[model samples]
Target chain A: MNSDHHVILRVVSKALIPVIALFGFYVQFHGDFGPGGGFQAGVIMAVAIILYSLIFGIAAAMRAITPGFVRGLAALGFLLFAGVGVWALIQGGDYLDYDALLGEEPGGHHGQHLGIMLVELGVLFAVSGSLVSIFYAFAGRVSEIRDEDW
Target chain B: MLEFILERGNYWAIIGLMMIGLYIAFAATNLIKRLVGLGLFQTSIILFYISLSRIDGGTAPILYGADLESGHGDSEGVEAVAEAGHGVADAAHSGAGELVNIYSNPLPHVLMLTAIVVGVATLAVGLAIVVRIREAYGTVESDEVQEMDLSVALAEAVDEVGETQAASGAGAI
Candidate 1:
């Protein structure tokens, strides 16, 4: 299929995609009060990449967002989160108990926030990379038409 | 009153967009169309989050310099007022006169960022599955693919029965 190279539309998408990404960042950092947080921001960022892939080809996108690397990264992200929870268990606390990681008092809050941040990062990694992986799975398949010829 | 109408009107527009997305998802038969529907549905969610974040006339929640001008009449809409005890007063303080209840809430914007990322990932996965299915069946259309699958299944079943009969004949011989 011929690719769409509509200059105006392309230009608009180019300009808007970054703006959307920046907006996601803004939401991510400022979500304490606003309606957003890491979850929503990650999705937006993924969409931006997906749109880029759609405009360009999947191969080009894979070059930009390596499917293999991302799959590993997604696994790593989950592992990191699970690791944190396990660490808490070792610290004489229940699973995912932030306070156990740190001592009592204000330290607990700090540990909690830190734990949450790490968890959020894990979420970001798994979510964003997995999303890319999913895209690669379908987009990367070899067609049956090729098989019929063989 | 005009501002109220405009605000509400924008909300309605967002709702309309959501409905359109839902319609696309439900009405389409092609797998790609369904993916498109999913995208529309997700986009509507982003819109909903953004729309809900708008407090009438609020500025973006980023705190500028300390002199950041103060508030107007206790606007019913603007509610993120800085408490008096906290010495670090935000834009909501300074002087109530300078305030304009139009600031943007940073929270929704942040959350939407993650949501958008997730949405893209979902789209990528869905499209990838569609592509793979197309590869396997030689077609991307839903009904045709189903028809092809049914025939293939029938053929497989016949092959299994034939294999069983052949084993029985071999034993009898």
Candidate 2:
């Protein structure tokens, strides 16, 4: 690869990742408001990382977003979400009843909002992790074989 | 009415988009086309769920209290109680005009958000597999690969049978 092209690719990857991540957060938070939310944001964020991998090669991208850490984060996020639902159930409420979690608020909507936020955080973690994993799996493969048996 | 258009129209549009995407996925023989179909299908479903959350005349569900008037407008409480038919006519009547028309339902939006994430992840994995397929086969056309693989399997089967017959005849001798 040309040095100039390599530099440009690196720069583009570095530049776009933060902007994409910021947008993902905005989508996740503003989801209650409009046409975006946690899943979309997570995917978009992952796509940015994938793009970086595609441009700069898998090693660089992997270095930037470590696989083991992401896997743990994703698992933790899922557990947190499941924990909330279980907590609600344990409180003598219907499985995921947000009101039970809130424990008798003025209105039940507050609990629903809180539950959703927590779930969204979980979703974000899982998405970001899965996406990075996909990139790593593909990018990790050696494209060319030097050993010749034929 | 504005409410009908926003609520119903969005649903129909999303369904239509989903069907078109699904059709492409089912019919397309090209890997990229299938991926495109998958993308379309995923995106349309996301749109569908997002649309479900919108309430006519309802603002974002923010608790700012600044635009509370423009939000649900406290009209729904009365209508809901009246609709429950607890014999509370006055409560229903008072809040009737101020009620927001089911502008938002956050649950579906949340689910769809997850759906969107899953969809993109699936697409990424699919595309990666397609890349590997293209690398190995020098083509990403499904029909072509299937035909080739089928032919190769048939040939191997025939060769195996021939060898088995030759061995049997030799044994008999």
Candidate 3:
């Protein structure tokens, strides 16, 4: 597919894909102090994958991150998020009571910070996985209509 | 009248966008067009919430004192200028003696972020369903899909009636 046409597209996208993914990670982690968060970061990361698939092909993209793996990521993320809440419950606090999860003091910021980070990480995984899988579902269909048909 | 209209220009824009979106969602025959309309409507609502969060002389919800001082050296001069400007405005508005840091409300912004995510997911699901519909009916037009469904239902009713008549005839024999 990369042999002939869209040479410029292929080259530019190849260079840009890593940079885009890096920016996604930056957004994910720096979200605590800035405007970005898990949702924005996840979408940005998913865009990198989607862009690659658009330039290369779905088959190549799937090879890098298979459907099964994507589904597992989504499930794992949900579990991670719920796990935090459940952990708080087990520690004799109300559900999602992050203060009990960490810190010696009842209302310390440490526990809250840790809880938010874990939850955001979970959201990041779930959102990115779901988006990529949705893209795959749309693109993997047989007998695609040509652009001119539209 | 002009002053009133110009002062509320952001709201006017939002209303215009919302109406356009609603019109497309109701009047468009193409399924894709309807989804596009829904997206536009969602976007307008998001814009409205963001606009509501704005304060006349407020900065972002983040604390600018410690972080700004420690992180960027150049931003100190900018921050000082902004503080000076705000001080003047504050004096004019409320006869201020103490410096007050006004920050825009962050709650609406956070809620809208979640709304935006939900909107994307909804749009994705809607488009996926539309794709399946097109595959099954070979068309994405709402009217055509309804017509095809009506025809299929009619055919099924005719078949049932024919079977009943044939059974009655066989019983008579």
Candidate 4:
């Protein structure tokens, strides 16, 4: 459907999408060491996908990553966080106790760091999946409503 | 009042933004405008809180390599563990020479980040509701919606009145 689009828009998106995704990954992994965190990173990732959808059409976007998969990812993200907390509890530590996982580590902060990073990954999945799914819902509904209704 | 305004100009501007946003959100008829206004209102509140957290020349709440307590000595609303690495804490703990204090609060920024996420989620729900309303009502205008309800109510009332009148007329005949 987007076959007739301007060459510049496609070219720019092709170059920019990878860069945006890379930045998002950086934010996700190196958040605590730097300024940004999972939330910003998730939004950035969602924006990259959305830009792709806008340029390549919803059908193509859906083919790449289906809405059902996005919804599952959102649920999985929440579950991942909850599972981590439960694991801490099972290990005879307080809920969300990162120290319990790597108590043997020297200086102790490394364990905390690892726990935070894992939790941030959960946050990234939840935010990005929800965002993309929301976009999909809106895009799908557009055809259901007529122009005159507005 | 003049002194308050002059001394707290940033506060006054923040208040102005809040008032404008509230007016637009509550008084405007267009749904999209209301959404925009709500966004503005949220932004103003975030700005207000962020401004509250700032100190004249304070640094970030971290000390790069120095291990300090997670709490600051005297700064309120700021868990500035590493602000300037130790002068203020040393002064407070040792009760030695007085030093100039400069550390901005980091708590408000932390809180506002969560607030921003919640705000976006709320806006998404609101827009979804607006879309559904438009689908069912064919318009999103507040007045139009009210007018439609009023007309429906009037018609229902008329129907009840006519039914009662017809029953009484038949009984008299």
Candidate 5:
């Protein structure tokens, strides 16, 4: 976990993490027209954090993202998703009826687009938060195994 | 027989992978190895679902011609088509009543995306449990943990039997 020993890894990961995060954002937003989506984007984003933790050590990663924050993020994402569905219900349509989301003409494409985007954003948040937290839970454990053990 | 096997080779490979995964899961005494086997099984199932979505000479399920023409290469073309009074389904068919594009089914692919995420979560939870087990029992082997549990149970049973015997002896006195 010592940063001094992994000079090359530290330098390379520092350079790559931002780009990986940017790509995750692109996938999250452009999911409507592409092969990528919330799940892919979420995993990609989580990988960046996991890589950071692996190279820089778990304490540094936890400092950067805190367990409490990630837990909140997961809850917030679920709320955003369910809130959208509830919004549709309040609009007098069936649950998750994206057409009712924007008060546009029933079955309008715009509402569907907006609803899908919001829902995917929620999924992105939930997936990334949950994954990073799970990584934290594992990394936070006290280990008797050392680098020599590998 | 050769042609038939060649044509359906993917299925054969899937079956092989599935059997390997199943064998590992059932036979491996190490908890981590069992989890790895479970992951392999999940991967093979994902591959199977993907193969089910494939169509001969089919491209992705997206609409192409109009979008290709726009040069912007965005979802605008889809909206434009809808605005032009063609329902999304109608656009896939030409006026000659023949299919212009054969698109692979996207449903299975979409469903499998959820499956993959669920599989990862399952793996993570399983690993966390294994880590806890290792911490508590000092080993990741399932047989070792079970043996330890059996010894503890036998010790507890002996203690209870001795205590009961002492109580009976006191009553007799």
Candidate 6:
């Protein structure tokens, strides 16, 4: 039951979604120097998409991002995190030892910074994917109830 | 008593919020309302931890320019470095330029971030399950679900009894 009306909402959402997505990326990458982080960024990213779906309808949203792809994306994101840890192990360092990721200044926190960045990327991917999938699941259940049934 | 109350006002508010959230989450019949209560409880808990970490006249938990120039790390010979850093930080704090070493614990804030993510996931999954329940049972009420379950149980029990009776009657014949 996507409202074909609400011309104002549609226009505003179209303008806002890109800016919100940019803000999400900013939060994801600038977390070390600032307050925002993967979880917050992921939620914000999901919110923008959900808002799009809210205005444009689930059919359009699904076409943009299908349910199956979303599920696979979530799994891949988790694997990316694990793979980073395993890469550390293969590099002869402890699991998730970002120090092993590069040969920067050993005393500095360069390696740790790299590792954290990678891990946060994984977190962003998995979190956003799961949220989108959850939204898709909730939205697809239209047969569960009619609008006035409640 | 008044002094104690004033000193711990934040904590008291947090506790009050917690109790209200718990009451609605446990006592409410509607699933969505219960989830909202859970969200409220989570907000209060986050606030409570944040309050605990607040330090009066403290700045952000970041090493300032002075701190960086002085150099600080989780290194050995920490006592010497700590003494040096402390003296500089203290002097800066009292100086006209304005600097402070006092910072609220960052660990609690970091841990709470993880907790919030977990809480959100739990809420989302819980709501999804609620939706499925509505699909299956055509109702989201806990009492209605229980009643449906009871009827299903009663029917199974009656079926079992009928099978035993038929078996016994055939054996007697």
Give the candidate number with the greatest TM-score. 5
Query: Tens digits of per-residue lDDT for model 1 on A1-150?
Result: 434557666778788878887986786666554455556666677778888877767888889878888888889889989988998899888899987777543212567777877887777677767766776766676554654587
TM-score of chain A of 5: 0.94
TM-score for the B chain of model 1:
0.65
Q: How close is candidate 1 to the true structure, as a TM-score?
A: 0.55
List the candidate 6 regions with Cα displacement exceeding 4 Å: A1-4, A148-150, B68-100
Q: Give TM-score, chain B, model 2.
A: 0.71
Candidate 1: lDDT of A132? 65
DockQ for the candidates, in order: 0.19, 0.33, 0.28, 0.24, 0.36, 0.31
RMSD of 3: 7.8
**Model 4: TM-score, first chain:** 0.89
> Could you tell me every candidate's TM-score relative to the true structure?
0.55, 0.68, 0.85, 0.83, 0.88, 0.84
Error of 1 at A22 (Å): 15
lDDT by residue (tens digit), candidate 2, B37-63: 989988887786677677667755444
TM-score: the better of candidates 3 and 6: 3
Model 4: per-residue Cα lDDT over A1-150, one tens digit each:
346556888888999999999999998887886678888998999999999999888888999989999999889888888888887788778899986766533223566777888888898999999999989988876556567899
Q: Model 2 over residues A34-65: C-alpha lDDT tens digits?
A: 66766677778788878877887778777877
The reply for model 4, stretches above 4 Å from the true place, is: A1-5, A103-107, A143-150, B1-6, B65-103, B164-173
Q: For residue A22, give model 2's deviation from the true position in Å.
A: 3.3
lDDT of 3 at B51: 96
Candidate 3 local lDDT, A53-90, one digit each (tens): 99898999999989999989888988999999998888
Docking level for model 4: acceptable
DockQ-superior candidate, 3 or 6: 6
* Fnat score for model 4: 0.06
Q: Which lDDT tens digits does candidate 6 get at residues B1-173?
A: 99998999989999999999999999988888989998999999999998898888887787666655444433222334445665534433443333336777788888888898888888888998988798788888888899999999999999999999999999999
TM-score values for chain B across all models: 0.65, 0.71, 0.76, 0.73, 0.80, 0.79
lDDT of 5 at A58: 92
Residue A8, candidate 4: Cα error in Å is 0.5
Q: Of models 3 and 5, which has the larger TM-score?
A: 5
Query: What TM-score does candidate 3 reach?
Result: 0.85
Please tell me which predicted candidate would have the highest DockQ against the true structure. 5
